[model samples]
Target: MGRIAVIGAGMGSLATAARLAVQGHRVAVFERAETYGGAVGAFRRDGFAFDTGPALLHLPAVYRDLFVKTGKRPLEECVELVQVDPASRHLFPDGTDLALPNASRAGVISALDAAFGAGVGERWGDFLGRARVVWERTRRPLLEDTLREDTAPLGRDPYPALKRGLLRRAPATVAAVGERELRHPGLTALLSECVLSYGLDPRQAPPSAAVLPYMEQTFGSWYVRGGLRALADAVYERCEERGVEFRFGAEVTGVVEEDGRATGVELADGTRQEADVVVRGAPGEPLPGDLGRFVVLLALRGARPADAAHRTVVHGTDAPHDGSPDGPAPTVRVLRPDDDRLVPDAGHEAAVLSVTVPPQGAVDWRAPGYADAFADRVVAVAGAAIPGLAERLLWREVRTPADTERETGAPGGAVPAPALAGADGAWLRTANRGVPRGLYLVGGSAHPGGGLAHAGMSGAMVADLVAGGPGGSR
Candidate 1:
């Protein structure tokens, strides 16, 4: 068995390390942070806990498979996974409220119909039918296997275009699909927010973006009992069980390349660790269109409402689809999990509000009062979801992209979106192999891209390639 060195203790790297250790390879993980989980961070104060990263898990089977493959214990035994019913509640700009049932097509259709009037549900259902086709066509190359060198075929748009009178103009972007098919402003806004939440601008996202909603609606949303931080803890524990070594606060400076292959990594402290293979799990610098999340964590004095939906999205009026710095008030997502662990007691509640915003490069998140001013706007908007929000607010903690940069080491605090097929593969991430011999890329910045599920898949693919021997570099 060869020695393997994994850089960064992000979800992908942790998954890769455990799998590699099980395969009889000597694996070690080096992380710059004092702890693991990278962007999947947590904050605790006065007995209240909050997940600072992703609020929900979609396609949880990815992690389930990871646990099953790496050890005898399954994911359920490691962490409690609660399926969120009434998947999400949406409040549109026109005061239209719609609650989508979890993983139930018929129920979602009926709900959409009841809120948006008759026939609107059918339109969305039909759109999802097309999205399902996209999912089937790209599932293997995009998620199930390593990214191929020639991704030209995957680059082409796969969403079938509607025939319009003698001329069939295929929709190039996600916005085009919404305008040409869904037609209703509310439906369009819903679709836009779905893409925007992933940090992709709906206006420029590929039609393959349709698969996002399909994946969510089909697999359903899940939450860990404590917070997403608990999921990270489970993965880290699994890595330890597999005999993987971990060195925290070890910053990798550069890959040590010799004879056209990665021998190991050089650390910031002037130490060099040699290994047979090097896996880079750190995210690359933020791209031009990359975006960051601004979160407002509210500690309320009263208990969570009995009728509160686990997730609520309040759509903004101006530039709802655009995630640029100059865009209008951003659409905000409010999360109020029913888990008691998040609150100090039944009398107190924790609510988190998040929105997509320009990365640190586009705007200075640290400029005095910038975070508070933006947070004020977000809280004012969230009042629509929480009854008597101002009166109930006990204290609020604001987190900006600047904080993300400091915590996660992602430049500009920008988050990477999942890979999409279309627009000539503009959205596809870097391949897992072929960059350099003995080196593999895993994480949100690499193949299959971001999201908890995609990160797990990237780890699996990287492990498979490593097991294939040196030729795997091809």
Candidate 2:
């Protein structure tokens, strides 16, 4: 058995470590932070808890398969997964409110029709049908397997464009698809927000970006019994169960190279840990113009309403739909999970409001009053969903891109979007291989790219390549 050194204790690296340990390899994980879960973190104060990262999980099978392969205990046994019914409620600028049921196409269609008048549902449904085609065409190449050496075919757009008139002009970007197909302002805004939520500019994102909504609507949204942090805890525990060693507060300064191949990692303390292979879980340089999340955690005085939807999206009137950065406000997503663990007591509630904005370099998140001013706008908008929000809010905590940078070591705290197959692979992430022999990239910045599920897939691909010996499948 060979020795493997993992650079970070993020989900992707933890998943890779567990799988490699089960495969009889000696694995050790080094994390710069004192705790695990790079971006998937939790905040606690005065008996209240909140997830600082992703609010929901989609395509849970990716992690389920990991747990099954690494141990006898499956993922469901590790943590309680609850499906979020009425998956999300959307409040459009035109005063249109709609609640979409979880994983039910018919229900979503009916909801759309009821909110936007007749025929709107069919149009949106038809668009998703086309999106499924994109999903089927790229799922294996993009998610299930390692990225190929020649990614030309995967670079081409797979969303079949409709034939308008005698000429068939394929929509290049997601915005074009919305303009030509959905046609309605509300529907277009909905599609734009879906892509924007992933930190991608919908105006420039490829049509294949549609796969995001397709995946969410198909697999449904889920929440862990505690928070997404619990899912991270479960994965970390599984790693420990597999005998994987972990060194917290151990920062990797560089990848040790010998004879043109990575041999191990050099630590911040000027020591080196040698191994047969090195896996880098830290994300690559943030993409130019990429976005980061601005979040506000609310401590409310009242109990969560029984009828409250787990998630709500309040679309902004000044959203940067055209890729301009000067918009007064961007779309905001409000999360109000019913889990009691998030609140201090039965009489109180916890809610998180998040919005996508330019990363740190583009905007100085540390500037006085910048974050709170933005938070005020967000709270005002979220008030549309949460009745008497101002009166209910007991206190608020704001987190910005600067905070994310300090926590994750990502420059500008720019979040990476999942790789898409279009615009000549402009959206594709770096390959898991080709970094250097004996070196592999596993995390949001590589292969299938970002998101909870895609990161897990990256781990699986790396493990597969390591097991296949030198010059493994690419």
Candidate 3:
């Protein structure tokens, strides 16, 4: 057994620490903040709670594998998965409303076909099949390996695996992939939605990411009962039970290296913790990856329109008055598909509303009067869905790109990492690794791009590398 220290207690760090500890290695984690979860963290105010990051959860299989590695089952006991219905409703300018399901391939296809005209379903299916192939081919090479040995050493290329007929040809961007599969512009819009969910533009994202929408629509979007944070907390709890120690409020400043090998981490306070292995879960340098900014406003009381479909619903005063006939009234609407807005302001209840903006650079995001102007624009866009959504004036909040970077160390506050669009950018992302012999890199920034499942698998792959050497187990 070896002593190991994991930097940052996000999902990736937790996964690594858990696996190492279960392997009988002594593991300790240092978190800059008082809590874990990094971007997946949560906060509360006035008896209401909100998830600060990763509001939508998908690919429970990744969490399942982590639990299994720790000698436990994830679903039956740890966290109960709540399947989302009508995953989200897409509101189009042409007055067409499409409801997407979490795991109903037919439902998604049918909805698109019904709204967009004939033959769209089959095309969508074919596009999804291509995505599935890519998933199979890349899952192991990218998700299950570090993709690099250490910093300054870029490791092996995973392209040969895809070239072996296991995956499809990857386009430079999601738009390119969708354009190749379907001729309809709406179909392209549907595919671009996947890019938005990952905080990227289809024109700038990797074609490999085209599989994400299929994953969400086929596997079903899910949420933990207490919110997504429960997943992080559960992982942390399991780690503790298995003898992992966590040091909160320890902001890591630098990686301690010897002979070009990572040996430990130096905290912001100058405390150096040594270990047989080290994992970096936070970004050290800023990059033009995925960026996200959100404003969350909560209502202290009263139920509102929720469920998977809420993500795309166009909020409006005329929103379907689907209030509960038997309990507290509830109504929610999606005002603008591109930006977040509420539909109606009329109601004698409390509610929480969230508005998300596209990913952009720090300086561009902070240009004078951007926040106020953006908020006003959202209100205007939502005016159609909710007649008085802007007037509801209960509470309001905003998160700038800089704030997101400060909070999560996410390069330029990007979420789900940037797609491996260009060969150069892809190589740059894949180049860094552990500086010391025993250390490694395993997170969204490492390989297979970002996503909960991919990052978790990255950690497991690193453990496998240590156990079986760089060649990996046969």
Candidate 4:
């Protein structure tokens, strides 16, 4: 059995450790932080808890496969998985409210039609139909298989350009598709918001971005009982069960290499842990930051409404892209879980408010009074859905990219954008294999890019690479 060293006890690293352990490889995980779940972390204060990273999970089958392949117990046995029905409630700038049902195409169609017009549903359904082609064409090469050095095939947009009567071609960018197909301003914003949520610019993102909404609306959005961190905890426990050892507060300074082949990791303490393979779960260099979120945790005075949707998205206005806080009202996501575990008691509610903004390097996210101003703008935007939200705020907690950087160790507190298929496939992430003979990359910054599900895919690719060689069995 080969000895494997995994850097960062993140979801991807943990998945790699667990899978390798099950395959008879000895795995040890090293985490710089005291806890696991790199970007997927939880924060608690004053008896209330909030998920500081991703608040929901889409395409859960990735984790489900990891659990089933590694142990007798399934994912459901590890965490209480609840499908967030009405996956999201969207409030458009025009006062349009749409509660899109989870995983039910028909239900979503009806919801859009009811909220907008009869044919609006048909148009969106048609767009989804087109997006399905993109997902099918790109899913295997971009997600399932190991990313190749010449990923130009995956980079070229697979979204089919529809022939509209006299026109021979369809739209190019995601924003163009919204304008041409969706027609209505509110509907266009709905589609754009999907890409924006991923830290992608809808204006520049390819039409393949349709896959973002398609994947979520098709597979469904879910939440663990306590929080996403609970799922991480379960994965960590599963790794422990499989004899994968972990050392918290173990900061890896650099890769210990022999003739360009990674042999192990050099820790901050000057001690070295040797292994046959090294899986890097942490992010690489920062690109001029994409979309970073400003989070506000609100402890409300009353319980969350029984019929409340788990997520709500407020679309922003098309303001100029000047480098200022008041440039444009950023898109906002508000999550309120029905589970009482997040709050202090049954009488109160804990809600998380997140607004997508430019990365810290692009903006002075930590300037004096910047936090309060951004928080007020976010609260103002979200107030459309939650009446008297400003008053209902018993207390609030704000977290920005600086907080993210402090937690994940990624430079500039930059959050990695999910890999996209466009810009000459510029969005394609680094390959899993061929870094060196023994070095490999895992987690959101690697192949298939970041996001809960995409990171799991990266782990699967890396595990396969090490277990079966570069051309390993997947």
Candidate with top lDDT is 1
Q: Which residue runs does candidate 2 get wrong by more than 4 Å?
A: 165-167, 317-329, 469-474
| TM-score per candidate, chains pooled | 0.96, 0.96, 0.81, 0.95
Candidate 3 has its poorest 10 consecutive residues by lDDT at: 316-325
Give the alpha carbon lDDT tens digit for every residue of 203-230 in model 1.
Answer: 8888889999988898899999999999
Worst 10 residues of 2 by lDDT: 317-326
Preferred candidate (TM-score higher): 2 or 3: 2
Residue 173 miss distance in model 1 (angstroms): 1.1
Candidate 4 lDDT by residue in tens digits, 1-474? 999999998888998889889989999999999989888999898889999889899888999999999999999999999999889999887778889988999998899889998888888999899999988988887788887767768767888756465766756788888887778887788887778778777777788888998898888889999999999999999999999999999999999889889999999999999999998987787444256767888888877778877899877853212235657777778888988899899888888888766666677767888878778888888887676787778988888877788888877666777777866776777777745689888887887887998888888889988877552224
Residue 19 of model 1 has an lDDT of 85
Q: Which model, 1 or 2, shows the larger lDDT?
A: 1
Clashes of each: 0, 0, 25, 2
Q: Give the TM-score of candidate 4.
A: 0.95
Query: What lDDT does candidate 4 reach at residue 368?
Result: 89
Residue lDDT tens for model 2, 1-474? 999999999888998999899999999999999999889999998888999998899989999999989899999999999999989999987788899999998999999989998999999999999999999999888988888889999889999877565677888788889889998988898888888889888878888999999999999999998999999999999999999999999999999888988899999999999999999998678666468988999999989999999999988852432213455555779999999989879999999998887788788889888777778878887899899999999899999889999999878888888989988878888888755698999888888888899888899899988898432212
Q: Give the TM-score of candidate 2.
A: 0.96
Candidate 3 local Cα displacement, residue 470, angstroms: 5.6
